[model samples]
Target: MPTSVKIFDTTLRDGTQGEGISLSVEDKIKIARKLDELGVHYIEGGWPGSNSKDIEFFERTRTMTFKNAKITAFGSTRRKDSKACDDINLNRLVDSGVQVATIFGKSWDFHVTTAIQTTLEENLNMIYDSVQFLKSKGLEVIYDAEHFFDGYKNNAEYALQTISKAQDAGADWIVLCDTNGGSLPGEIAQIVGAVKAHVSTPVGIHAHNDCELAVANSLAAVQAGAGQVQGTINGYGERCGNANLSSVIPNLQLKLGYSVLSDEQLKSLTSVSRYISEIANMHMPINQPFVGNAAFAHKGGIHVSAILKDASTYEHIKPELVGNKQRVLVSELAGQSNVLVKAQELNLDFDRDPQKSKEIIEKIKEMEHQGYQFEGADATLELILREAFEGLEEIFTLESFKMLVEKTANHAVVSEAIVKVKVHGETIYTAAEGNGPVNALDNALRKALIQYYPDIKNIHLSDYKVRVLDEKDATAGKVRVLMETTDFSSTWNTLGVSSNIIEASWYALVDSLRYALLGRTRIEREDKDQLEQLGVVNH
Candidate 1:
């Protein structure tokens, strides 16, 4: 059997170093609990000696129990020329009350002389004494040889001596760090392989993503016999970020035949990635590998047409292996199959009518050429499908609408809208006030129809976005507007595009309420399996 790779997650420690990433002690505790549930081998809770917040985190979590993960503390090695036993940082490791302690010491000769101003011999002693002192405290010691790769390239003999000292001092894990994150996969493999012959200690890799090669470097290290992989969820860290464990675990377990996570834990990868992003208050990048919204999305005509016949023609692995699902997107780039597949998934009765399919595809292509994209507007797409095939009657016919924005020197700007509409052949005129023209329009429309559809009071537009299609067109550029609406339980997106920004906002605003009134009921009755597979709701 192949050696099992240990996963050490450092999101709470190294990850928070990234710009705009600030987690409170409560957030750190939440992440630690989730990482424990993720079955990671170790969770590097922050450095207790460095800050009051981390000290509080260690104190609070000292009594909490984790089934699979050992809570670990991160800190630097004892200061130069100091005995490990007398060091405040080292003693804080013992004080942090964790079973495992990870201490990093400089490995690069350049950092030793130029950065730390320490003699080469003392750096080695720092590595040795720190690991030994922690081991003496009955804590599992993970000695991170900071800048190990750069150190090896610049002074191979000295770098080898540093870890040799840690190994001699009984460090439980000797992890090689690509601190600069500049080493390529081949260099990583070659260096780790060379170091393997010199040390009897189990090896590990800690890679960053400055060059976007952290995952590759980690895998290369493992392939060369490293036993552990240290990374953070979603690659959160300083600089480019740390190696993304969401991608690394799957690559090791599924692609490379390595055992890193259990089958059930592996299946929870996508949700875990998003859950952390939510708690961290960061939007998960849509294109992030494996866990991103676009990771398995297909939009091109040829790809969609092929995947419909056999998904294997395009996809490499079943998306469910990492808890992600395959999504088919429709646009001007779509083929007839894209229309047919998405329509069926939404339970639209196209009835296999080739001409109807052709006409719909043509309309979509024409609209996309005019800057209308259906990719994020499934609600709007449903409205189009209903109008074409079902001939669904309009909820209300708009007669006319007017908006006014006014400001006085001493008072805040105010917006008001007047709307007229014929509901069930009875014309109604109403007006409303709002902070913006779009809000005012939405209010006036609601005022016009609230009596007919009392449920409209329960729904509100939660998000509104506008994108200019052509920069060169300048002020005349066509604009696209997307409105996100929710009743708190479920949310959906609607879209509209036109050269007139107000017109675009009007269309999307109207569709959002129309979906709340009509399309929501119709979309819910679709085939469950198809909806689940193709993804009916996009937010």
Candidate 2:
């Protein structure tokens, strides 16, 4: 068995400090459940005494049950001139009902003198008293020496004294935080090694990413004998964010051969990362390491050919180990192998017909030249494959559509759309109103089709983005629209190009619906075929 490093996730506490990340108590609980599912050792719930929302979050977790992660409450050391026993913050930590308590105290003499406006002796007293008081309440105290790295560099003796005080006061784990996030990896390793020499208690690392070295510094600290790693999922925090646990966990487990999470738990890393991003209403960084969408995607022609032969040619490790799959991107720069690999992944049989594969590659190059980008729109690519190779049948044919926009006397604009389509030779006409022309068109189209395909209700547009292909043409320039739709189970993107924005949006929207309905029809046909082969008669 490899040595185990405790995975301490501070997504709820530090991660919430990220801009545009605001979680309701419910959102925090949902995320906490996911973290527990991921087998994190400790989850810093939030700063209990700092806000009512955090207080309510802890209150809600008391009724919940977690199988793996221990809930920890975070706060600062006792305030100036306040006794630890009487401090409101310390008392709130005890009342938070968490088994673990993590509190930060000033380690830098500058912070002690200027930030806290306290003497060095009083700062040490605060650290000692707070840890002892929390321990007296039967809580596991984890002391966070804020700015320990910078403080160690400035005044090594005083920096070591803060952690020593907590150690003597029964701190379970003394964590050295690079609060300013400016320390390099080399400095972190040397400082952490020095701290281990001074304290008998286990040491941990809490690093930020201002210098883009949080993950590097964290790994460096671990190499220096730190047993616990602190980070936020997707690196969500203030400034440049904290070290990303999505990257850190896999590195510690697979790359370094340290046991941080179980194999099953490790596989949930990608889902956990996306889940947090969804809850935060933030776009997951496409290039984020280990868990990003493009992490294992091959694009270069030579790279794709090599990857098709052996993924090890370009990939560092099997993406499936972390619940991510390898992707072969098809584009103008892609080779014939890229087309074949993508076709195979989509269940298209292009192996026996080399001409069809060549046709797809040429068609993609021609389309890309006309402002059609298929790289981000897999559903659109699948549609093209089915049409070219499998001979996809149309679910519905559009007859005509009209839109009307009217502004009231008060300047409130209202848009309405009428759509006409033929489903199995039956004409369906519907009308709807919406806040905008595109929305109205979406509503009218759905109303016309929902009667024939009830599953259409499950499909909703999640995102819509538009880009002008030629900026020099200005108003007359061609525009490209990318639309993302989800059917509750999976999400897909489609692309459209036209001179008119509404026309572009309409093309993408129709493709989205057609792709979804076509998939359902195919599955139904397959089921019917299977049943017929099994001699089951339908009444």
Model 1 lDDT tens row, 489-532: 78889988999988999999888888888854455445555677
RMSD (Cα, Å) of model 1: 4.7
What is the per-residue lDDT of model 2 for residues 376-402, given as tens digits with 9 covering 90 to 100?
999998999889898988788999999
Off by over 4 Å in 2: none
Question: Which ranges of candidate 1 are over 4 A from the true structure?
Answer: 424-428, 447-460, 523-539
Candidate 2 weakest ten by summed lDDT:
1-10
What's model 1's lDDT at 279?
A: 86
- Per-candidate TM equals 0.92, 0.97
Best by lDDT: 2
- The Cα local distance difference test for each model comes to 0.90, 0.93
The whole-model C-alpha lDDT of candidate 1 against the native structure comes to 0.90
Error of 1 at 450 (Å): 4.5
